[model samples]
Target chain A: MIEDKKTKILIVEDEMIINKMYAEELRSQGFLVLTATNGGEGLELALREKPDLILLDILMPIMDGLTMMSKLREKDLYGKNVPIILLTNLSASEEKIMSAITKNEPAYYLIKSDWDLSQIVEKIKERLSRKV
Target chain B: MRSQIQKKNFEEDLTNARIAAQNVLEDLDIEKTKVEKERAKEVAILLSIGDGLVVTDENGNIMLINKVAEKLLGRKKEEVMGKVFSDAILGIEDKEGKVISLEKRPMNLALTAGTATVNSIYYYVRKNKTRFPVAITVTPIVFEGKVIGAVEVFRDITHEREIDEEKSEFISLASHQLKTPPTAVKLLTERLLSGKMGTLTEKQKEYLNDIRFSNQRMIDLTNALLNVSRIELGAFTIQVQKKNACAIVQSVLDELEPITKGEQPKLKTIFPEQNIMLMLDEPLFRMIITNLVTNAIHYTASEGEIVVECKTINKGETVGGKLLKENYFVVVISDTGYGIPQVQQNKVFTKFFRADNAREKHVNGTGLGLYIAKSIMDHSGGLIWFMSRENKGSVFYAAIPMTGMRTKVGT
Candidate 1:
């Protein structure tokens, strides 16, 4: 069926409902999806799977997304080059968020409440297309 | 016989002179006692002042300091008296924790400029190496048209600051928590409406759409409340950069185009041939423009028109009795909509103030957009005002100084 050939995406979110909903939507869109409830688990899965793209949430238990992203970026060439999009409820004007975005090159962020699920899917697709 | 008469006259003259000298000495003693009483009273008044008070001489030397000042500075009166004002009370820092330069110290400014300076965003370090936020006022002491020294009064605002920080923290946390449910609902509703799970009837779809709309409104209210809290706390950071004014306005218009589509109001724009480069916080500038335009659209009828014009003016005009002077990059948003009633015009920028007409026309407004916008403008060294008649439309004007927005490093 060549199901294994589909592009893989990893979602690291602490909220179970949101993670499940996103996973369902992306799976229906014909992408292989992996989910992690926290940053530590997300980082381990990301390193092992080497997914095409990572969707990260900033505020999480057992290590935050930025910490994990930085650690992953430090791991190897594959980690440094992978596309990571930060999805959070934090305002972009926040000092911490702004600084983190500037430091993490080639990273994009979307305020979850401000963006619709469809728009987020569209953004994911746009990022994947650009990577290709 | 003549010698005896001369002796008697000489003795009488001597007695009168002696009496006059004794009376003069008594008067001098009484005057000295009164002066001492007045001086003691002045000293008592200075020592009893609630706020920390320090008086300096023309050369910025500390002349007198009250008991409160001594306790706050963690130094004895004998130790700091006659020392340089700024040096005696060392380690003054700005809100960013940067040490204040000598030239920028309020006492120095008051002494040099001969003006009163009041500031609340400063921290003072005590002798024990402990620091606390302070609200300080320094006034130049002038006598007979000559600039003397300065009088500084300060209070430790640690308690007030703690309360404010707690309030802001609570609001931020509450707003985030409040938004999460709405976000989940919005996403789930969108997923259900996509019809990937099952085929839905028209009525079901319509009901889901209503749910989504209401959920979106809840999210908007949360955001607005958060912004208001930030404004009240003076915690919003402003990073100023030079950007094209026209381009910023165009971008806002583009973002609002989706809402404008299929709406009754016809949106139009007028831009100068040459784009004006203004120093502004781009996001904040965009927010101001968006708020005004959105309000215009919401208030105006479908058959009405909305116009957004951008231009540069060498001199500013007074609108609604507020004078906006100097060179400015101005944006004027005018709409043919239900205007605000004249009786309620003054309260347009107040929090939670919706005019009777506005509440009647638009039901979902949180009445915070203009208040937040006005606070931002005031912080940015910009101006926002409008004129409206009950029956006619309203015109809102926002002016940004050519010099640029005031950059603030805030939480």
Candidate 2:
């Protein structure tokens, strides 16, 4: 644990400010951060990079977080087992998002406005620890 | 000879005057007819409207009914003519389906109160004994300071209600969508303030804190607006799952603890050894508890004592409307804050209604918290009320049914 290298974290968010800020925060926490603007790009990165954890967003321009996750799960066997936390502002009742959640993997829904960045970092760490 | 000529001229002048007076009378008749035509046109316009119109005399007898009214009540204008207003339209009730008393009826109220009663939602039974909701306005026909008659114009609101529900659904969805950008702003601000980017000077940190505070307010406002939209639009959904009641409260307290770090009020928590498992929608339960407790912390003075207690009440105990035989949970959050003004207590739960004292004390409250809480409670088989004294303290009690007694009924 003491000689641990940086944990690779993928933040799939549409908004630039949120993506940049989260990436920086995770970087500060000694996690190598990967960024994607939309779900399509996110799916590509997830397949290529195979990060330690993912922070997914629900809503996006071209293909959403859930769809990307579905595609990633199909393409990568370890994707389903990887810890993914939903970081978005959409309501929990959104049908498409809910369906995406069910079809893919178990993920935590974190409302962006509800939790601070530090709290989100804590959640990411907690989920990673759980996987171990 | 000159006097005879002058007398003859005077007689001619009188004849001309008589002819002029007859012409003036003819013009008056024409004017009267024009005025009568305009009145008829006004009546026709009223009758042509889609809304049902019923005019009653001071004695409450039906004087007139429009085509729409006749169709709505399933009664002909002739059949209901001279009939008592209440008798002809017999099954008049409040929104709750209880018979409206004579005095409480809009027409009667307009007559007695000498004011127009508008936008009252009431149910009217048709001749076929089927009841439908109607939005009505009753205006007293006043003549010489006397209540001569009353005209009630109403519309069958079933279609309108449907449209309203549809609009509410849109707003709920739109509000949820609208929150995404603000959430991004909030996250970035939080990250910046926590020195994620780099070490900052004190002044720079202060500016970031200001931005963070402003961002947090936006977050709270948007959340409140979203909740209100969901409630008002009848788009609220509750999913009941088994969870520990105490854990829910603890999470809410934890969320608020960061804000209350400085000059934190003393929170006394009383939790059971074995946490009672509650069948509740975690979000809704959290909302209710969080609102009450947050209000307590916000309103209370620094270092004031706030007690957050939870216990079980057995069945047959008269709580809110329901007599519960099953185990019910009661969460009491009391605080030594500026208690609600006694005069404004009744309106505490009303939407967008802030008491004078509260408005004077806190500038940030949207006055929608208690309203959203009450609505959640009403739908979730829970009841929320409070006992408060001016300048003393307030104790808010929320009783939730543990058996998931939810109603599909919504306003």
Candidate 3:
């Protein structure tokens, strides 16, 4: 009998508790989960491991999510094609996030406070299932 | 003898005429001095003005440029006098940094339209090409029903703009910080309720749900406060795109299904068969519809009905007692609920205002929803109004011009 490979997800968030909560939830949902405390580490992990999808936060300490996404997108075909979902508490009306979404073409932009962990898992699944 | 007498009389008469001529010349000199003094006083007044002032002739020529105007423009009065006003300015840009055309210039608009125009979102470029924001007021100098010229008063608004930006930045930062903990609580509670951690009794599940609900409310309050700050500061950005109005309203209704399920008021929608496409900021539009529909659901009784309708209205059509001036895509939300008191109708859109009857009902409300909705409508070049009778029901109308909302760039 052959074992099926689980879909992998990388969560790049600065807040320790939020990162842990999301990772736990996704792990419970039967996916391999990787976590990074900031965008710099996230980018490094993403380039090395090449997760199926990346969950990025906008306001991180070292390198913000947008800058990291831009660098990763420029790296190679794998980095460019991977789906990245932006998770932020900032209002969608923020010009910086709006323009970044337009430029980076993130899979989805979710407001953290407005969404549930279950709903987020559903979104991730939907994104992964879609054709590239 | 008579000829001698006549000659002497003629000489006397000539001497009298010469004395009268000298008196007249003396009076003329005194009057000239008085007139020159008055002219000097007027020039002193113009030069002493604190704000930049420019006077233009009917032909749009710079007649006079005051001291402050010269300093602000980085050009001396002697250099710019008699030059075309728009040409002499060189670079005048709108809020978006786009060069304002000659026809759109405030001075020219005032001249042509014979009305006063006030604008604060203009950048004036100095001789050295350094630009600064300016708040300007231009009024046509009309004399005897004829426009002779215009008087433009402007002041540098760099300090005011900096303060406004600081305020907006502070609110945004504070709101983000305030929301983080609530978000954590919400997510953690959801994780507990997911039942993967451990088996939970009904009581435990109910308690966890309560915590989640309260946390969500805190998150909502923080968001509402942030929105109010943005609206008050005029710092909200608007991105307009062609969108189906009916579809947007329907989406709002769909999102509210969770709250409207079971024994809640019957939700009804009346949309035109053909989609009404209009330019709108989708999220802002959604926010507006959500606010109105939620209010309708909250205020109406469980057995009552709430209707959401969308239709296109033409010019001269009357809505909410006001005659429309142009084509509009309107959404009407009518509810069979506790209507606003007649006296309180005027204050419905004001900030932090809840009706006496609504407060008595004890339904949870911030009273900021309608105010925020109205502000969004005003900024979008739209209209929001309502008609209600106490103890009967209310009909709220929100209309956006068919041409669409004007895109605004702010914080």
| Candidate 3: tens digits of C-alpha lDDT, residues B234-327 | 7788889999989989988988999999978899988864598889999899989999999998888899999999998899999878799999
lDDT for each residue of candidate 1 in B1-411, tens digit (9 for 90 to 100):
899999999899899889888888888889889999999999889878999999999889999999988889898988888989897556799767788999899899888888798888899999998888999999999999888999999999999999988898789879988987888898899899999979999999999999999999999999999998887788889899999989999999999998898966999999964578878899889989999999999999999999999987676565545666788778999999999999999999999999999999999999999999999998889999998987789999998988988898776
Q: How many angstroms is residue B281 displaced in model 1 relative to the true structure, after the best TM-score fit?
A: 2.8
Question: What are the clashing pairs of model 3?
Answer: none
- TM-scores of chain A, one for each prediction: 0.94, 0.90, 0.94
What does candidate 2's lDDT look like per residue over A6-47, in tens digits?
678898988888888888888877888999999988888887
Order of all candidates by TM-score, from best down to worst?
Answer: 1, 3, 2
Q: What is the TM-score of chain B alone in each candidate?
A: 0.83, 0.62, 0.82
CAPRI docking class of candidate 1: medium
Per-candidate DockQ vs. reference: 0.76, 0.38, 0.82
lDDT computed for candidate 2:
0.81
**What are the per-model numbers of colliding residue pairs?**
1, 3, 0
State the TM-score for model 1: 0.87
Put the candidates in DockQ order, highest first.
Answer: 3, 1, 2
Docking quality band of candidate 2, CAPRI definitions:
acceptable
Interface RMSDs of all predictions? Answer: 0.9, 2.9, 0.8
Q: Residue B182: error of model 1 in Å?
A: 0.8
Best by DockQ: 3
